[model samples]
Target: MLGHQLLWPVVAIVVMLVIDVIAVPSFLDLRVQDGHLYGNPVDIVRNSAPVMLVALGMTLVIATRGIDLSVGAVAAIAAAVACTRIVESADEGAASAAILACTTALAACVLLGVWNGFLVSVVGIQPIIATLVLMVAGRGLAMLVTDGQITTPSNDAFSGLATGFVLGLPIAFLIALGMVVLTAVLTRRTALGMLIEAVGINPDASRLAGVRARTITWTVYVFAAVCAGMAGLIIAANTNSVNANSLGLWIELDAILAVVIGGTALTGGRFSLAGTVVGALLISTLVRTIPSIGIPSEANYLFKAFVVILVCLLQSPRARAALRVRGRRAASSKAVAA
Candidate 1:
């Protein structure tokens, strides 16, 4: 069933290659330096890594027919908190200031996650309304964390999460990859998978079947918050500075697009993590290719707009049904020919 899901993407890649050969000629070599790889592909992976984490959590939320538009806010707040604390601790004469800062960053993010969890789980507020409060107020919280000052920190090890590497791979990319694999295992192997799907299909039915529907909903939101927090820290690490207003802005939209493009239905009850990765790659590639072909920056966004529309159209029930119907017809024709 999953292999069937991947068919069109595989075909798309082949078509891209054929087009590249005809038009760009040397398009395969997207390198910018002699040995150092650079350009849109690299930039895509770098920028997309943090969002991938957030999108991953969003995918889970969406699977349950819910949304968390506040992840971007949480991410920004996490970044601000991390930056402010790191700078403050250094000023306070801590011996291992960077370590303290790192701990503080992660701790702050977890606290925010807990707060989100409480509001969504314990308070029983609608996920959209509940998360919206934080979305609006979170930047203020971030500003308060730094006393309304932009935070600057000088730390080598702290920045390494975004820039350094244990192997040749970027740490950001590796972390995102690990999350992809982890989600794959979580949804594919455990009873949690069935429970999540059940909840998505019908909450009342799921509850009657002994599934803790509310608990699942709570967990998904918390998980999403944690991922957003982690992504915030990563972005902070990458840039070494934090501005509450600028960080993680409007990222919720991108996550939804990625999930939908990967074949996950917004209506709930279905998700595909592997498909999400391909969707992310597709997004990254499209963004990268625009400038590679000399398109203007404003026009580049237009390209993204079109691809998003195209992917969403392909995921529509009518389109999916058509594909399945065609596949079944092919099978019938083959049998008759035999």
Candidate 2:
């Protein structure tokens, strides 16, 4: 079990670091000429920010033994709402477009989260089906928000959230870090996290013990939506433009991959936030190292798939059981021969 906890992400990190170290050969002889890191780490950090946020939520959702297929759609819808408000604000001159964009996105996210919570908890809809409704319609709503036109906000304050940096780090990175700390605090520092775990491990038992399962599930969805909102804001700020159709596209997959690769189980029984963080870093590093070695972008998907396969391969209960059986068989043969 300890081996399972330690191996995959460590291997991934070591491999990535080695590739990055050898990223440029002797002929290339590339070294840092500027005060910055040897590589342009901003893009990787920025792009991975959203995925990390989503995965953090996914870690909770998966812990509940529920899957949220609508996070990508939620992100798109949130961005659409933010951009729509930005465009409207620009026309009316009532407020800065950036402020309006973020506010609207966050508000919409909270409402949508409540909606998801309602369906999944109160209405008893299955998690997948409940979220699927939003998933299918969210992009269309996003198109409606902008009248199918892309929006670019001129406001610097809101854009600064994505673009501005502090103390030599991207602002988005700080935001992601803050959220991670909050998550850790919520789960590890308080009973909130314990309740979530108990509910995830066994809902009926948790309820029998006087825990409110419905409330727990609802809060989880809301939390997931907030994360999605943050992700949307980060992406929108980074680009300074919002394309409803393409913005935050398919990011849900990355989040799930991160959550799973970090050693969190898909079944609602186990979670490890630290593992998820490492998984996110491993993914970003993998993507960054790929092009450095002249590998095609298409290979990245394959590479991630392979890593996920390994995560499942080495840690699966069946694999451990098989190993145990093999060990026992060898012991039995030795004892009989003796």
Candidate 3:
């Protein structure tokens, strides 16, 4: 059953890759340059890293029947904090400055997460509303950090995070992969995953069964914020600057789409990290391929929307049943004709 559920998303990714290959023959052309792997495949993975990380956290939050709409804003704020700190440091290129900048930025994000968790868990605000508060305010906070200007910082240690390579692969990709593995291990190897699922599946029932629903909920929100923070850092590092307004603009929607495309229910319950990863890759591929295929920039979003809708329809149970019925009817007709 699980395999069946997961199959369509995998197929969708393959289909998109095929489309990419057809549109741009060199899409799959990979080469080793300067001891590092370089290609479209590499770019897809590297570019999708931020969304992948955000979606990973979104999967957890969604599993708990919650949404963190503020992730993108959190990303902006994180970038703002990190870059502003780096620029302010006298020794901007020093490793110590980079470390401090990252730490401080991530710490701020964690606190923001705590605030989000508090609003939902203690203040009894709806998850959407609670997160919306941050979603709307976070960018403003980021702007304040950057003093309402784009922050350009020159720091090799920071830039190395996004541009550097590790073991012949992009460091960004490696970091994202590492986070995915860590999240999977931390959740699956312990009772945490089960507890979270239980809470997500039925908070009232889980509480009755000795689950700390509040703690689980709060923890997931914090984790989501942390993920957003990390993603923000990656975005800033990639550009070697921070544009608070655009750093993670509308990324929450992308993360949510990734989670949904991966087969995670928006209504909450069970979630899949593997599926989310595939979904993020699918999105990244589309983003990269659209421009190559000569789609007008103005209508690019329309094409994406259409594809998303088609994929969702294909994943629908009713649609699948109808497709099977049609196949059966066609087979019977063929037999009759024979």
Candidate 4:
């Protein structure tokens, strides 16, 4: 559905689904209960929503030849700010408090993005180094926000973001889908997509050609933080608590992996939202499949690494060429034997 470029990711997911179906025959059974859908597929999508949102923003950042290592940290800060605000509110359970908490959290994320953007786009720091500063310190900042303790606020309105369903679908997934669509429309329907690619492909050249390269880069960093912020809110809502230390640890790595698996080169240039969608789903499916198929929990990372490495090799042009050369040599040997 996302063209030939997405074939491998799609195939990987399909294979996993097939395996899941065999391992758990009822994997695909969908039952509606209380106006909500329940099943492995639904669960996978729901579970992957936060990652998808982060990856969506990561895609744009990568497309602009930049990285946001601070995304996970930024998410933690956002959750900390939000949950702390709600807990300190006069009415923690009030809808207004939840709304205010969300707004404040996103605003804090925006400011953090501005700081990152300033360092990279304005101060001329390497994206990785610039974001790394925050990555290392953001947890401490979050701890400060919550006094080094977990904040568990009682807010049904906020919790609904993660636990509630709308029209038989997960609200988190729907939010992700909406953001994906909105991002697609804004980038594709306008000249912004080309400008971003141009900057990624060659910043100096694009700047000479009248593209606002720094502006584009800064904007993408900010957007990435906002996406991370939304993801943080969802994660905090899920447990109805915010543990700054663990809110979004290592999620940045997953977002980067999703972007790479989606066929977006780390070196930048082109991007595909649809590919990312498949990639995120693939990652989620792998998580689900591992336990269901009896893989040891201790080896989960290793197993996932193996699969990811295999897929990456399959996707590499040089690797494909080497395989082709081997195939040709084997063919010649067979002919000579004949």
Candidate 5:
């Protein structure tokens, strides 16, 4: 059942790779230097780490019939807070400073998540509207935290999160992989996954069935926020800097797209973690392939949009049925002519 759910995305990613190989002869080339791997595939995964992390959380939120528009803002705020904390630390160069900065950023995200959860589950505001409030104001909040300035904090330990490698793989990718694994274990090995699905499928029914719907909903929101916070840290660490206005800008869209492409229905209920991972990889590969194939950078979004639409259509049962009907009609016409 899992394999069937994931087939489309897995096939899509493999197709993208084949395209990459055709467009760039060296696309598959990999080498080891100084105990670290280097290659386009590695780079694609490394660059995708942040989006992958954000998408992991988005998967759960979407599974619960909730959308978190504020994730990008929350991520920006996390990066801003972390960078500002590092700059303000008495010893910004120390590893301890990095630890403190990370802790502070994630803690702030928790509060933001709680705020979102309260508005949606407690206040009874629609999920979209509740998150939109934060989406619009969270960046301003981030700006205020950074004193309306870009923060570039020099911290080797902090930068290592993005730039460093472990066991011949990028640290950032490893971190994302770990999160995916952890989330899978939590959701699959326990009752949490079923509870989440129950709430998403029908909140009132789940509540009557002895499931804590509100709590489950609230928990997923908080987890989503923390995941965004971690993604923020990775993005900021990549450059050792944070720009309140631009950090994590529009990333929510990418995460949402990834979830959709991963075979997760927008209406909620069933979700595939493995499919989400492949979807993220496919998006990242498309981004890389566009430039490699010499498509103008300005029209990148156009190409991506086209591909996304095509994938969604392909995923639709009605669309597939339409295609099959057309094919049969054409065959009948040919047989009549003969």
Candidate 6:
């Protein structure tokens, strides 16, 4: 069962990798320079780190049959807040200022998460509608923080959060991997996973059974926000600047696609962090592969949409069954002719 669930995403990733290699023969090449890893594969993972982090939290939120449309906006807001602080600091290079800026941005994200939780769990707003509120307003808030301008801060310590390397691997990738592992351990190692699934499967039943559905729902939103915030920090560090409007644009869509491709049902129930990671990597690879494969800029999105649809269809049970029936029929006809 597990293998079947993972089959399509794995296949998609392999197919994409093959395509990438075909398009750019050096796509698979890897080497060490100054004790740091460098390659297309490494770049894919490094670039995908932000989306992977967001998808990790999105996995839990989706497990509760909820969605966070505001993750991108929240990420932008985090970047805005952090960069603004760093830029406005008397000593931009000060480690203390960088730390304080990051800390403040993360704290704000937590509060934003709490707001989403309150709307969904306490006020009984639809998750989509509740998060949508922020999706629209959060960017404006981000712009406000940046004074409606792109804020660039020159701080080596802050930039290192994304660009620095540890043990020859990208620090961003390491941070994302750590978050994935921690999330898996927290959810699966405790009773939390089961309770979350129960609530997702049947909130009323879970409530009746003494599983605090509201609390689980609320917690997931907060976690999602924090994850987005972390991703925002990495993104800001990557560019050493924050463009409030475009910083996290469309990232929410990528995160959702990652969650969907990871084999988690939108209807909610069980979830897999490993699968989500693969999905994120797949999306990241596709983003890089499209241009390298000679797809026109104008038609890029169309090509991507077609590939996504094909993958989703391949993963569908009915589609698989239909294909199997056709294969069996073809085999029978061949045998009879022989």
Work out how many backbone clashes candidate 5 has.
0
Clashing residue pairs for model 1: none
What's the CA error at residue 265 for candidate 1, in Å? 1.2
Q: Candidate 5 at residue 301, lDDT?
A: 99
Off by over 4 Å in 1: 1-3, 9-42, 91-96, 320-338
TM-score per prediction, in order, is 0.84, 0.87, 0.97, 0.96, 0.95, 0.97
**Cα lDDT computed for each candidate against the true fold:** 0.76, 0.79, 0.91, 0.92, 0.91, 0.92
Please state the error at residue 277 of candidate 5 in Å: 0.8
Mind giving the per-residue lDDT tens digits that candidate 6 earns over 1-338?
Answer: 52386688888889888988888898899999989999988888899999999999899999999999999999999999999999889999999999999999999999999999999999999999999999999999998999899899999999988988899999999999999999888888999999989988999999999999999999999999999999999999999999998998989989988888888888989998888998899888888888888888999888877877887888888888899899999999999999
RMSD of each: 4.3, 3.8, 1.3, 1.9, 1.9, 1.3
Root mean square deviation (Cα) for candidate 4: 1.9
lDDT of 3 by residue, 1-338 (tens): 62365677677778878888888888899999999999988998899999999999999999999999999999999999999999999998898999999999999999999999999988889999999999999999999999999899899889988999999988988888899999999889998998989988999999999999999999999999999999999999999989988899999999999999888998888888988998899899888878877899999899999888888778888889999899999999999999
Which scores better on TM-score, 3 or 5? 3
Of models 5 and 6, which has the larger lDDT? Answer: 6
lDDT for position 321 in model 4 = 78
Supply the TM-score for candidate 6: 0.97
Q: Kindly report which residue stretches of model 6 are placed more than 4 angstroms away from their true locations once superposed.
A: 1-3
Tens digits of per-residue lDDT for model 2, 203-300? 99999999999999998999898898889877887777788888878888888878887888787866988877777777777777777778888787
Candidate 4 lDDT score at position 250: 94
